[model samples]
Target: MADFSSEIRQGIQHISESVFMRLCEKVGTSQRVAMRRETVDIKEMVEQQLAPNDGTIQMLSGSDREGFRLKGSDVDHMYWPNDHRVIMDMSQSEYYNMANTTLILSDSSESPPGFTLLQLLTPTTDIDVLLTCFRINDRVFISSSIFRQLTYLASLPNSDIHGPCVSGDVAGLEYDDTLCFVCDYWPPSASSWIDRCQSWPDPEVVDDIVRNGCHFVAVGHPLGPHANEEWRLSFSQAEYKCVYAMNHSQFLTYGLLKLFLKEVINHNLGKNNTLLCSYHIKTIVLWTIQQNTLPHWCPQNILVGFWVCFKLLLKWVREGICPNFFIPQNNLFLTKVNGSAQNRLFLQLHELYKKGLACLLQSSSVRSYIIDVLCSPRLYICTDESIIKCEVDSDVELFSEILQNDKTLAQVFYSCMKYLYKVQQLIGSHLTQNQVVMLQRLTASILKNSSFILHNMYTYTGVNKQMYIADKISCHMLKSAAKFGCVSDMFYIAMYYYRTLRYREALSVIEMSKVKLAQPYLMYREHVDRDRYTEAVGGQSWSTKMRKAVVLDIILDNAICYINELIPEQQAALHNKQHMLVIPVFLMFHFLEFLCYRHIDTTLSQAALDELQVLVHYDQGLFVRDIFRDISWEILGICQQITGNLQAALYSYQQSLEQYPLNLIQTATHTRIQDVVSYSQNSN
Candidate 1:
């Protein structure tokens, strides 16, 4: 009977290992996780560099920063003025230049374990901060409620306040922006946590966490006496670093726990009614790792790690005490998880624990993996080579998404040449290998757009030495951009050549671009022939193929990349603050080829014109994203009008007006239609 029990346990372990292997493929492998971290870091670095130098720091937090692309997850942004500093005592204020800083002292004596009252030590000249302060007991203290209200006022229209965050929808995704104050010193409340972290995180990580200190968010404890005046201590930066330090298996396990909470627990107990959240799950994982509860956190032992976290959560629920990871004395669940709610939650967790591995079946995200593992005990679903291939595929998808969402043109226009110089400085700074490659890609984009702006500026100037110098500089910048940019970036050189009336040189560049675009590994937008991509670039590292693999769009900035021929179309896109005239690579390629060939060979020009017509008519979202469809049709109309097909050009303009008005070129299309109609009437 004992032997039989041991065999059963061994079988369960084997099944768990297999399920975890499948999870690794689904979630991400170690290499993929590392790559994602590097990508996020690089993006944050770029954002910081581009942000206005107005003594404010902006940081991305929450799951997005943690490298999880979970559906419905909100993008969290934390921004704080650097001049407003919070200190534990007045002595800490000596470190700052008082003339330029607003110092606030943290008073946690009467507050909750993780909360504090911010007393203004010096009068702030800033009206926004001054309005949030009031005199109490001969000391001016910043009112949390007033601070929150002031922050909310600056939020997006139709946004609502959620605790310290102002929440709203941005580009169809939910965003939470929090206004916080930075503290240069580590909170004494979390001193025990630093001492407790003797292992798992290593000493250097702990030191880095402490050196970065914490933040004071404008949110008071619900049960504290100073509810309206208290500010909660936030370890967001420290928490992000901790999550970054997690091993891939551990990270995947954390992701699984979150999935379970969302799909199973919350699904059973209504999302709005549940007290358990991703934060609670994160805390459980942190404690489990720090306490060395699990012997190993590898792919094979992922299930065991998850089970340990689950039992710890159950214990917390039963005891009605969910301690904060940074300050164990602070109970995270004190306000919500108690009394009947606590009892009910405990019973539900207990019932799920009794169901054992079968409880995972309730999670739709991982249910199929669990079922597969159970159904095929002998099959090996994961191997090292397969996992590496999966990582590469994930890298391709991530890189493509980043390119598709590129905003380099607008950023460059906003910052002008200052942004370019900052990027150069970033490249020269100490950076990881992956960071350098990512920054190089960004630099290429900035250079390409800046050159276009420079050339456009020259078009408005007289023929002189300055014009000649600007022309040479713009040409050289384009050459440098093509050297560091992706396959599609070569088209910029062709466009420049054509713009200067060098038809033969433009044709030569266009021919080279066509050959590069034909490469199997070249990813265009979200489209990639995966099998061919793998076959061609499978052996290369992600950094090696990152630049050469993707096709970036050509965005014409109305305020910068001004072209006299496209002024009518560019005028339509000027409705927004950042007037973007986005054109797909394929559309621009064919249009430029036709334009250049019109000067060289009419036959080839006709062929290029025919191809453009076909693409504009039959493109089933293969060449253009839906948002750019109107522009595509409008481009087609322009070409048709040039070809003297007045009736066809009028029809194309009508079709352009019929699509979604996102391209914002309906006014331009109407003008073109009227021009075509009047020309036809005069001809008849």
Candidate 2:
């Protein structure tokens, strides 16, 4: 019987290895994690640069910061005004500039573990702060409920409160922004966590974590006596650092636990039920890792690591005591994870444990990976090297998508230029090395777009001294942008030349751009040659590879770069949410080629026109993103109109209208259709 049991364990371990091999491909590898860290840092820097210097610090948090790009995950943001500072005791008040800071003393004597009552130490003229404070026995304390209520009131228009965060959907992405106050000292309640980290996290990491201190979010323990008055201690900064320090396999295991919780457990319990959350999963992983519960956290042992965390969670649920990682005295499962919910959750977890590794098959997100492992046990081999290559390619694609979604042409143009001086100041003093690189990229984009706007503004029917000076400045800016920008950015130079009727120079630039675009590692839109990427950038550092390797689509802002001939079409595109005409690089490239050739060579112009039509009609989302399809079709219709193909132009306009209305150019398309009808009538 012992022999049979040993055989069973061996079989499970073998299956576990295969399962993890597949998970590496699905959940992402080390490269993806590193890229995600850089992406998060860059975004944080950009937000800091753009935000008004209102004595507040903003941080991107949650899974997005943790490096997981899971679908349906909310973007978490934490904001704390520098004016408000929470100290552990009155003695710590010496550290603050009392005149500029609203000192708040943390009183945990009457509160539960991991919770504190903030006592205002000094008088404040701030209305918002005053509104949230009340006197309790002649000592003024900030009320958690009032603080949360004010945050909700001041949140985005459609936002609602979700614990400490104001939750809302913006442009289809869910965002959770938490308003909190900073505490410069690590909470005494969690001081034991530092000692506990002696075995796992390096001593330096522990010291750094302690030095960063903690935050007090506008939330209280539901079961605590002073729930309304108490604020919950948050270790989000320390938590981020801990996650950053995790091994790739360990990170993937955490991701797997989250996936299981979301796809399997949550699906079974339904959305209305809230017994377990991603935080619970995180806490489980953190404790398991810190305690060295698993002997190995390699890819081969990822499932084993996950199983250990899963069993621990089950034990916690059975006992109705989910301890906070930092302060074990604080039972996280005190409220909702008790009573009927506790019993239900335990039974569910127990049943899953009985099924063993088979339980993972229930997770829709990872089910196929398990099946793939089971079916091709012999073929399923995932090495660190292979996983890194796969993940780097995937990271390139994801980063490209993020760049497209996050930075709109108009936003980049206006925001960077508007805050140029502030951005420069922050770059020198505040930003990290990675953030500075990202800022350079942003600077390039700003310079490129600014040149276009200047060129358009100074454009004249006849060349003069003013035109000459503007042209020189615009040309210089475009050349400067190309140095920091992607290969596609060079097309802007071609665009400037074409717009100024320098056909030969434009064609020369276009030819150069075409050669660079043809490079195997030049990723544009959704197009990426993985094998080529591996060959070209597999060994380079994430930042270096991204700088020299990844290519972004060239965006033409309607307000800035559109030709005068397409004023009507440009005006129509401005009705979209971004309030700018956005054109994809390939579409713009072909359009420019057609225009330049129309001035110099008719045959080449017709060929360029034909190519543009083919790309607009037959694009498989490799050239244009789906969100901009309407505009792409409109461009085609406009080109057809320019060529006097009235019937084809009308058909193209109708096609444009048939696509997503998000482009908000339907009115423009309708106008073009009517114009085509009018022209046909006039010809008859």
Candidate 3:
């Protein structure tokens, strides 16, 4: 529903306001009217597209500040902030001539002797992206330069000799070049500058960094003259989204991140980079910068923490200095965004594996990596049992391509799995309403690609093992989920306990859960019939599975009990008051029936759907569309299949898929679906 996507705007002159107003409302309703207007003044547009503090740059004309450039930040702003220009005057020309070709130097340390330089544009536009400079009369000792690629520019000094300044080397930066500076995160040496910076940015740079930016739709021959487009930048600002004023020094690191993140950016000029480059050019300048210099990046924790990303990337682009940044190779970024999840952190982590199969079309590289990491089939998880039949045949057809030999592929899939687990956890109410909304919108916008999910097949594997760490993540998410009124986590917790055969505990959780449902009652009944034990058993595998299920059941039971306390039952008119004291006396126990229900499917298999069905049938008051959409249909279909009704399962799956229509769906996919389509078509 976008007014014009980079895909849509490829060949349109003007998009009718009426046609795409809905899209404008969703992404940038406030700026659409002002954005659609055509104007010949490219300078005005360029200035507008600059960062929030762009005005501060002009104001600091009188100040001695130098070596600073601007950069564009997030996608909230249109792709190009200062990309359109009609070539008018000297100052204006410098802004628009930054297209065509630009050189990319990965790390400065890779280059020896002097500095590394790459040609930016084919010819030249009015814009200058880099401000190169060195010391005054000391060519033997260089200071720093700034890259023009952020909302505002860093006013690095040309004469500030790095002296004995040491830059740190990152170990695994090659991972996410998507945002690599020196590499990993902050190395040890680069983190000492938290106290070194005296100046931040000029005042003008502060004024222009804004929230809503100008949008332009222009095209011509690629890199050809007369390719007209509108551009916008400066407007308003905020703490998380705006530019700072007096405390400019606080944001130099922000400027640094914009540069090295491997993102094509847009912005206006901030300080003078080429100022002293022509006069003073000599010594090696070591740039020290990183994202957050707190804790690990703390000047104390890591001896070479300054090379961390976000900040290090900024330093690399601005000051033309790059050193290895340490990226953690041991990241199991699946459950928690902070590296791991709490409640089933290890459970999710264990799933942090992959079976080299992308719809039977495997990526050899990914397979190789998985084999090496998983140590045979033992390390991987296979959701599709049917695929086992085709494994030998697939290898025969694909030859060695099916072999998991590529290390990079394994790493990538591992990363994907990690992301999926995190995303799964994120689906709970723990995220902010805005974050939830954003995630849903994003999900809707991007079709749920099974392949994509397979790509992040293992985002995190084993981030950390500390029980406290997992609890911390769970605690944070559970709280947020509570606040936003989204208790996906609570539901899962309750289910987990029931699965482990903790009957009493599971009942307590369901009764206390904020969400009122008869499923808890049903689970309690099931648990009472099975999985209950007085003491520990000695079967190892049986015990482990039972233990995991028990924990989950206990958690669920606690949630159920909590609900009773939350909504003190309507004053019992006929009940004895003395028995009310007994009502408060609750036993802490777990249920195994719910655990069996919960563990039925990691992909939310038919069991969970059946539980939801019971809730819908017995508890209309607890039914909510958002909680678990299409569960009734899913259960009905699956139940029919159990009764040898294949047609019903297919129909039910189709209904479920359509019931929760996402934001974005490929038209191609609409005509054909996996679980439902083939069966339905064959039957027809």
Candidate 4:
């Protein structure tokens, strides 16, 4: 699809300065924005925003000028210089492609192939989805306990819980419920950019918005827009209660909150969200996600680490790193080293190498992408470093004498990495492991360490590695192969590609591994996971083999539990069109063909799996993992004793855990392993 990042960055900076400033200049002079952001107005964009539009939606509308306000809106205004072509291209890509090719409008023709792969994998993909999870308070408690409370999600053996029952209507209607979040519609004229920002028609649009989540401009003087508690309280409150810190009521703003939410979900897809923020504010210490751990360690979004990385990179360069630096179109130039600067960069890269790629990517998804993207071979890096002992040792190194050792350098490096990661994830990241390896190799070779990798990517993998390597190589070769080194290397490799903003490359590297990374997609697991997967399949593969492999494995391996979730219509649909429906389930069943019917097929607690089994015929091929079949059956024999029946509660649990790869559960699975060991655990 279209590169949403550039538009987002452009939009963000535009909102901050050009949009906010001019509006404020006009409105600050008059206390209002001239138009509503909700409407499509051609005149407003051309004349006011000073931006062009593709033939489609003419102008951005705004009516609720006072309801919302932009604070520090001019902070990053430089990124949004008055560029008409940029704006025009954004409108074109969004209106023509992104808008038209959405899930709701899917059809044989109008339906893009991207959504298909994602469609078939829903039940399994959704197994890990957190219904209404969020980090409350600074400590970042997880909501799996809440998920544990839900009989339905809990019904799926491997699924984890989110928060207490936070239904959309009643999600925040609890005793602790703070301000009620609202996005009520505004009249067209009272519409302003803020209104448009608050309302998105499509989930994809919303996702895009979330990723490029708007940064709040705290309105009140010192603290900003977040200062207005009056605007946040519930309308029915009698005597005002300062329930929580930041007045939960007035707790808005503070730099792209939606982006932060996406990050939280990315890191904790099916795993517990224990790292939720603490409810009380004063004790709210800054919770920084471990450079590697992310939402798991702190599922809540912690932008500090990312900020450090970005700031450090900026500091090192003493200027802005052009977005083009990471995604240059010319291939030959990709590897061309520019003399001293190149050498200097190479030397600095050694430290990164020593720290290891895993260490680099451990934090969140965005960091992984950042490291991978910037790691490209052609980057102009600084080579050697001299102390300038007497302040005259070298030209660029001349200033090096004033500072001290590598610790300061290390700190700066750390900051750059963190910032690069957090910033990119906010909008989107596009790096991968193979690219990271390529970058590592490129960096090592430049530093006279090129031979570190077992093979040259361009030669072994191919030219234009981004397009050359398929998802297969990324997993079967790069991730699983011993040569690329440990997961850390792969992770950093992913981060390197991501920073260069090569989202596809970044995603490949992270997704290659069996386990989830703490990156943004993982942090905001449900949304990014679904959105990206859907986007990749282009709408046609959702209900097919292309669905995420892990999800498919879970479904087929435990066909019964999945069937249990379906209603009669679904059953009739599957039965009525066995010719058609069988294909998708068949694909999942076949993928885990290594695990047999005698095991998974007969093992389900729900009658659904059994019903599905009778509807289709199996190929004559031998089952792959026959050993797992007996092993799983043996475990079922024990559970049978506790539940007192062959097809009781134990059977469902057994069926849920049956078949498929063991590793998927190794991470997200939460269980009470047991109180004591028993010798009778062996017999089937």
Top candidate when judged by lDDT against the true structure: 1
Better of 1 and 2 by TM-score: 1
Q: Pick the candidate with the highest TM-score.
A: 1
Instruction: Please provide, for model 1 over 218-261, each residue's C-alpha lDDT reduced to its tens digit, 9 standing for 90 to 100.
Output: 99999999899899999998998999888877888898898888
Of 2 and 3, the candidate ahead on TM-score is: 2
Better-scoring candidate (lDDT), 2 or 4 = 2
Top-down lDDT ranking? 1, 2, 3, 4
Query: Compared with the true structure, what per-residue lDDT tens digits does model 3 show for residues 1-684?
Result: 134475433221111111122122221221211111111111122223332311211111100011122222111111221222222122333433254322121122222211222222223232333332223233211112222222122211111211111111112111100100111122222233223233322324322321122111111112222111111111112122222232222222222222211121111323221121100110011123222233222111111221233233233233333322111121112112222223232232123212111111122212233234234323333222233322222112111111101011111223333434545665663543223333332221111122222222222444445433543443344344333222122443443334334445555555555333222221121132122222222232321222222211111111122222211211221121111111100111111232333334333334444454454345433232332233334434544454445665666556645643211111212332363556656778
Number of colliding residue pairs in each model:
0, 0, 144, 146
Q: What is candidate 1's CA lDDT for residue 676?
A: 90
In model 3, the runs with Cα more than 4 Å from the true position are 1-489, 492-511, 514-595, 598-645, 656-660, 663-684
- Taking the tens digit of each residue's C-alpha lDDT, what string does model 2 give over 1-684? 133486565565666666566666667666656756775676555565564334467788888788777888999989887677899988888988877778899999988899989999987776778999888899999999998999888665577888888898754788999999988788888888987877777888888889979999999988889888889999888888899889987888998999899888888565567689999999999999998888678866767888889999999999999899899998998878888879998998999999987899998766776687577655545464454445455656555635633343233344546755655676668654445556666667678878877776667546687788978988998898787666667877887887788889999999887777678776665567777877887776545565566666555455665476666766766654235556778888898888889888889989999999999888888887676788788888888888888888888888888876554677778888888999999999
Candidate 4 local lDDT, 294-396, one digit each (tens): 2221111123223333233323232212111101111111222335544554454344445532333443423433353345423332211221121111111
Q: Global lDDT for candidate 1? A: 0.79
* TM-score to native of every candidate shown: 0.81, 0.73, 0.25, 0.19
Model 1 per-residue lDDT at 98: 80
What lDDT would candidate 2 get against the real structure? 0.77
**Model 2: how far residue 444 lies from native, Å:** 3.0
Better of 1 and 4 by lDDT: 1
